[model samples]
Target: MSEPKHVVIIGSGLGGASAAAALRERGYSGDVLVLGSESHRPYELPPLSKGVLLGDAEEPDWVREADFYADKNIDLRLGTTAVRIELGGRLVHDGSGGEYRYDRLLLATGSQPRSLPVPGTDLPGVRTLRTLDDSLALRSAFSAAERIVIVGAGWIGTEVAAAARKHGAEVTVVDQIQAPLEPVLGAEVAGVFRDLHTEHGVGWRLGAGVAEFAGGPDGVRSVKLTDGTELPADLVLVAVGAAPRVELAHAAGLDLSDDGGVCVDATLRTASPDVYAVGDIAAQFHPRYGKRLRVEHWANAKYQGEHVAGNLLGEHEPYLSSPYFFSDQYDLGCEYRGLADPDNDELVVRGDLKSREFTAFWVRDGKVTAAMNVNSWDDGDALQSLVDNRTEVTPTQLREADLAGLG
Candidate 1:
C-alpha cells in the first residue's frame, strides 16, 4: 500500500500517542487522529500506582505536551468512545454518532483492570487501580483509611501495599498463592518481594481466598476470608490482573488470540489488510521467542508503537525485542529484561540476595535468557545487551563481580 492519506488510531494511551509521534517522525505527511476514551491526555501508567497514589507526584508524566498535537497537526480526540468498527467501509463510529474514515486503522485500545466477581465489590470503598482517576480516588482514601485490605499479591497489589504502608495505613495483602509474584518472578525472587512488604509492617494472608466483602452503609467494613476469618478493613483494593480491550476487534471479525487480545503478526498487522493492533491489546508475534505473545509492560508498549509505525510506513521488520519490566517498592527498585521462564531455567545470583543489592540471571541452555537487577543501577543497558545477543555464560561467570565484560 502507498503512503496513506490519513491514519486513524483508536485509544490515546502511550502506544497510540507514540504511534502518532513516530509516524510524524518518520516523515509521514498523512493526517493522524487519536481517539481516547479517557478525558486525560496520554500519560504513563507506572506513576499511577506509585508516585500518584503516594502524593509524591501531582502532575502526570504526559507522553507529549498539549502543543505537540497542535504543532504536529494531529487531531487528538479525548473522552470519546469508539462504538463500532465499520470494517467494510474502513471507518470508525464513535458514541457521538460521528464516523471517521481512515486509509489505515490502528487499535491501541489497551486493557482494563479485571474486576472481582464476588459480592460487595460494588461498595463505595472497594476499588481497583487502573487509570489516573482510580489512583486519585485511592490516594484520597489512603489519606483517611486506617486499615486497608488488598486482594491479590500481583504487581499492582504489592506496590499499593508499599505505598499504603508508607502513608502509615495499616495494610494487609491477601493472595491465594503461597508466594506473591511467584508466577512471574519465581518462588526464590518472589520471596524478596514478600520480605520487603513484611519488613514494612504489611500483613500477609497467603493461601487464603476472599469469600466475600461485608460492609455497612459507611463503606466496606471488612473482608471475609475462606478460612472463616474476617479482617477489618476501611477500604479494599482489588488488584487481580487486567484484560485486553478487544470488543471492537472481535466485533469486526478481526483475529483474536486465545487470551482475548487482537491477533497480529510480527509487523503488528492484523489478519485484515489495513488494520493493525499494538500495545497490550495486540497479541504480536515475537521473532525472538518464536511465538505470539501479549506483553503488558510500558516499555514493550512504547517499543511496539514505534515499531508498528515503521512497519506501517512500509519499513517492514519483525518485532523481536525481548520483554522487559520494572517495579519499585520501599527502597527497592528493580529492572528485569528478557522473558524468563522459571520452570525451564536455573537462576544464578551475582550479588548477595540477603543484602538485596544484586543482579540475578536466568540461564537456560547455558545462555542468559533474562537478567534482573535489584537496588542496582547503571547495568540495565548491558544486561539487555546480554539477552539480545544471546550471550552464553556459566553460572560461575554470572556470579563473578566483574561479569559485565564477560557477557
Candidate 2:
C-alpha cells in the first residue's frame, strides 16, 4: 500500500501516545489524529495502585509533554469515544457523531478492570483502580476508612493492601487460590509476597471466595464469604483481572481470539489491510513462546507501539521481544525477564530468599528460559540478555551464581 495520507488512532494510553510520537520521530508527516475517551492526556497506570494510592506521588507521569501534540501538529481529541468503525469506507465515528476518515487505523483501546457480578458490588464504597481518577478516589477513601477489604490477591490487590496498611487502615485480602500471584510467580515465589504482607500486618483469607456483600444506607458494611463467615468492611476494592476492550474491533468484523482480544500476526497487523492492534488488545503471534499471547505490561505496550509504527512506515520487522514486567510492594522491588512454563522447567535460586534479595532462574532443556531478580538493581540488562540469547548452563552454574557476564 502507498503511504497513508491520514492516520487515525483510537485510544490515548501509552500505546497510542507512543505510536504517535514514533511516527513523528520516523519522519511520517501524515495527518495524525488521536481519539481518547479520558479527559486527561496519556499517562502511565502502574503508579495508580502503588505510589499514587499511598499519597507519595501527586502528578500524572505523562508519556509525552502537554505541548507535544500541538508542537508536532498532531490532532488530539480527549473526552471522546470511538463508537464505531466503518471499515468499508475507512471511517471512524465518535460518540459525539464526529466522523473521521483515515487511510490507516490503529487500535490501542487497552483493557478495563473486571467487576464482580455479586450483589452490593454497585455499592457506593466499592471501587476498582484503573485510571488516575480511580486512584485519587481510592486514596481519599482509604484515608477515612478504618477497614479495607480487597477482593483479589493479584498484583493490584497486594499493592493496594500495602498502601492501605501504610495509611493505618486494617487491610484484609481474600482470594480463591491457595497463594496469591501463584498463577504468575508460582507457588514458591508467591510465598515471599504472602510473607511480606503478613509481616506488615495485612490479613489474608486464602482458598476462599466472596459469597456476597451486605450494605447499609451509606455503603457496604460487611462481606460474607462462601464459608459463611462475615467480615466487616468500610471499603471494598475488586481487583480480579482485566478484559481487553475489543468492541470496536469486533464491530468492524475483525478476527478476535477466543479470549476476546484482537488476533494479529507477528508484524502486529490484523486481518484487515492497513489496520493494526497493539497493547493489551492485541494477541500477537510470539515466536519465542510459539503461540499468540496478549501482554498487559506497560513496557510491552510501549515497545509494540513503536514497532507497529515502524512497520507501518515500511520498516518490516517481527515483534520478537520477550515478555518483561516488574512489581513494587513495600520495600520489595523485582524485575522479571522472559516467559516460562510454571508446570515445566527447573527453578534455581541464587542469593537468600529469607533476606528478600535473590535472583531466580527457570531452566528448561539446559537453557535459561526466564530470570527474576527481587530487591536487586542494575542486573536487568544482563538477566534479559541471558533469556534473549537462550544461554545454556547447568543447575550448579545457576545455583552457584557463576553465570555472570555469560550473556
Candidate 3:
C-alpha cells in the first residue's frame, strides 16, 4: 500500500469538512489540509439565509470552531483560496502568494452566486444572499428598509422571503416561472409554494422577468418588469442560481463541461490522475442512471465528498449518490429524492397540494424512479428506505397508503 502523504482540500464548506472527517473516520493518519475561501472558520451553511438571518441561530452554532479543526489535526486555512491547480507538479497557488504541495487534491470550491447583468446590479442597496457576510449585510439593511423585491423565485429567494418577512420587511418575489422553485419541484409542488408565500402577505409576480434596473440617489429605486410595470422597491435581491467556480481548473488543461464545470467519472475522478473533484463544481456521471448531472445541493456535496475521501484512502470504492435536495419555504419543508426529472413521463403519488403536507412520487413507465415530499423522512432502515430506495408505488396506493413506512 502506498503511504498517503498530503491531501489538499479546497473550499472548507460542509463538503470539504465532510471529506476530511470521512478520511479520519476510515482511519487515515496522513496530512489533511482544508483551504477555505471565506475568512470565517469552517461552518454549516444552510442557516445563513434562514435561521441565522432571522436571528434564531447564532454564529457560534453555525461554525465548527477553531479548536475542533485543531483537535482533528486538519490544517484549516481560513481566508485562503486554491485558484491554480497543477496535477503534474502537485502544486496549488493560493490567493495570498503561497503555494501548496499535495499527493491528492480535492476541489470543493463549491459554486458562486449567479449575477444579473443589469443597470443597477452594482448598486449599493442591492445584494444576493449566499454567504454569512451577505446575510449579515442584508440583515443590517433590513432594519431600515420598508420593502424588498426578490428577482428570482428559487430556493434562495424563498428562504430570503421568509427571512425578510420575519424582520418586518414587505417582500415581493418576481420570476419568469409561474411559481417559486419551479425547476426543482415541478409545477405541482411549486404551486403550493406560490400560494404559501402569498398567504403570508407577500407579493408574487409570475411570468415576469426583470427588464432593467432603475437606480436612485439612495440606491436602487425600482425595477422595470418585462410587462411594463415599474415595481418600486427599497432593496433588490438577485437570488437566481449559482454557477460552479471551475475556471481555474478548466484553464489548467483539465477537461470541463461546456458550462465550465469539472467533469468527473463515477468515482469522482477527473481526467487528471491524482486530482478529484467534488461538491457543486464536479459534474458527476451517474453510473446507475447513465446521465451526467451537476447538482448544487447540500446532500450531494456531503455524500460525494465522503465518497471521494474514502476512495482517496485506498478504498477504491465507486461513488454513487442518489440526487436529492431540500428547501424550507415558510413553514413547509420540501424534499426530493433520486433524480426528479420533469422531462420523464408520468408522476404518481399521494399529495394534497392545497394542504401542503404530503409526498409525491415521479414515475416513468411502470417503475417509480423518484419521490418528493413535504416534511418527509430520511430513513434507509432495511427495505422501507426512502431516498436511496426508489420503490415503485402506484398513484392510487401512494395516495392512500401511509408513507410513514419510509421511517
Candidate 4:
C-alpha cells in the first residue's frame, strides 16, 4: 500500500487530535484534516469533570498547544461535524454541506452523555458534564447551588459530588446499584469510592432509581426518587453513562458490535482497510485480552490515537497496551491499570482501605488482571507491568511483597 495522500479524521477530541499530531510526527506529509463539532480546538474531557468543575483549571486541556496544529500543517476545522461518510467514494460530507475526499479516513467521533428519560431533565438547573462549556456552566452553578442531586454513581457523578461538596453544597448521589461502580469495580472494591465520598460530606441514595424532577420555570426544585422520596435540589446532574456517536459509521455500513461501537481489528482498522476507528466509537480487539473492548477513558483515547496513526501509515502493528485510567476526587488521586471483571476476579488489597491509601489488585487464575492504587502513586509502573506481563502471583505475594520487586 502506498502512503495516503489525504488522511481525514472525523472528530477533534484527543483521539483525533493525537492521531493528527502523531501522523505529522511520523513524517506523514499528507493533508491531515480534523473536523470537530465543537468550536474550540481539540481538548481532553477529564478536566471538565475534575479540575474545571472545581475552578482549579481555567482553560481547556488542549491536546496540544493551540499553535501545534497549524505549525504541523494539520487543517483543524472547528465547529464542523461530519454527518455522512461515502465509503465507496472515499468522501465525507459535513453538516454544513461540505464534502471532502480522503485517501484514508479515521473515525473518532467519541461519545455523548446519556440523559435520563424521566421528565423535568430539561429544566434550567439540570446539567451533564461533557464539554468545556458544560464544565464552566457547572462551575458557575456550583457556586450558588444550595443542594446538588447527582444521578448515577459512576465516575462522573462521584467526582461531581465531590466538587459540589467542596463548594459547600449539600450533595446527594442516587443510583439503582447497591454501590457506586459496583459493576466495574465490584462491591468490595467500589466500597472505597463510596467511603471516600461519604467521608467528604457527600450523601448517597444507593439502590434507588430516579423517578422524575419536580421543577418550576426558574429551575429544578427537587428530585423525586422511584421509592417516593423527594430530595430538594437546586441543581441536578445526570451522569448515567455515554453512548458512542456512531450514526455516520452505521449509515456507511460499517460493522457495528452489540457493544454499540464500530468493530475494528487489532490495528484499529474497520472492515474496510482504508477506514479506521478509535476512542469511544471503536470496539477494538485487544490482543492481550483476546476480546473486543470499547474502553471509554482518557488513556484509551490518548494511546489508541497514537497507535492508529502508525496503522494509517501501513505499520500494521497491533496495539498491545493494557487499558488504563486515572481519577482525582477531592484530595484522593488514583490510577487504574488493566481490565477486570471484579465479580469473578480474586481481589487482593496491599494497604489499608480505611486509611484511604491502598493498592487493590484483581487476579484471575493466579495472574493479576487489573490493579488500582488509591494514593500510592509510585506503584503505577509496577502495577502496569504486572498486568501487562500477565505475571502469575498468589494472594500472599500481592498483599505482602513489594510490587516493584514482584515478578
Clashes of each: 0, 0, 0, 0
- Each model's lDDT comes to 0.90, 0.90, 0.79, 0.92
lDDT of 3 by residue, 258-318 (tens): 6667998888888887788888898878776886778888888888987888777655666
Record all residue pairs in model 2 with backbone atoms less than 3 Å apart, i.e. clashing: none
The whole-model C-alpha lDDT of candidate 3 against the native structure comes to 0.79
Q: In model 4, which runs have C-alpha deviations exceeding 4 angstroms?
A: none
How accurate locally is residue 143 in candidate 3, as Cα lDDT from 0 to 100? 84
Candidate 4: give the clashing pairs.
none
Clash tally for model 3: 0
Q: Candidate 4's residue-wise lDDT over 175-261, tens digit each?
A: 999998899899987888898888888889998899999999999999999999999999999999999999999999999999899
**Better TM-score candidate (1, 3):** 1
Q: Please, what are the lDDT tens digits per residue for candidate 1 over residues 1-407?
A: 67888799999999999999999999899889999999998998999988998789996689999899989999999999999998899999999999999988999999998987788888889999989999998998898899999999998999999999988999999999998898887899989889988999999999999999999778999999999989999999999999999999999999888888998998899998799999999998878888889999899889889888977776678888888889998899999998889877899998888889999899899999889999999787779888998888888877864666865
How large an RMSD does model 3 have? 2.3
Candidate 4: count of backbone clashes, pairs at least 3 residues apart or interchain: 0
How well does candidate 2 match the true structure, expressed as C-alpha RMSD?
1.1
Q: In model 2, how large is the Cα lDDT of residue 169?
A: 99
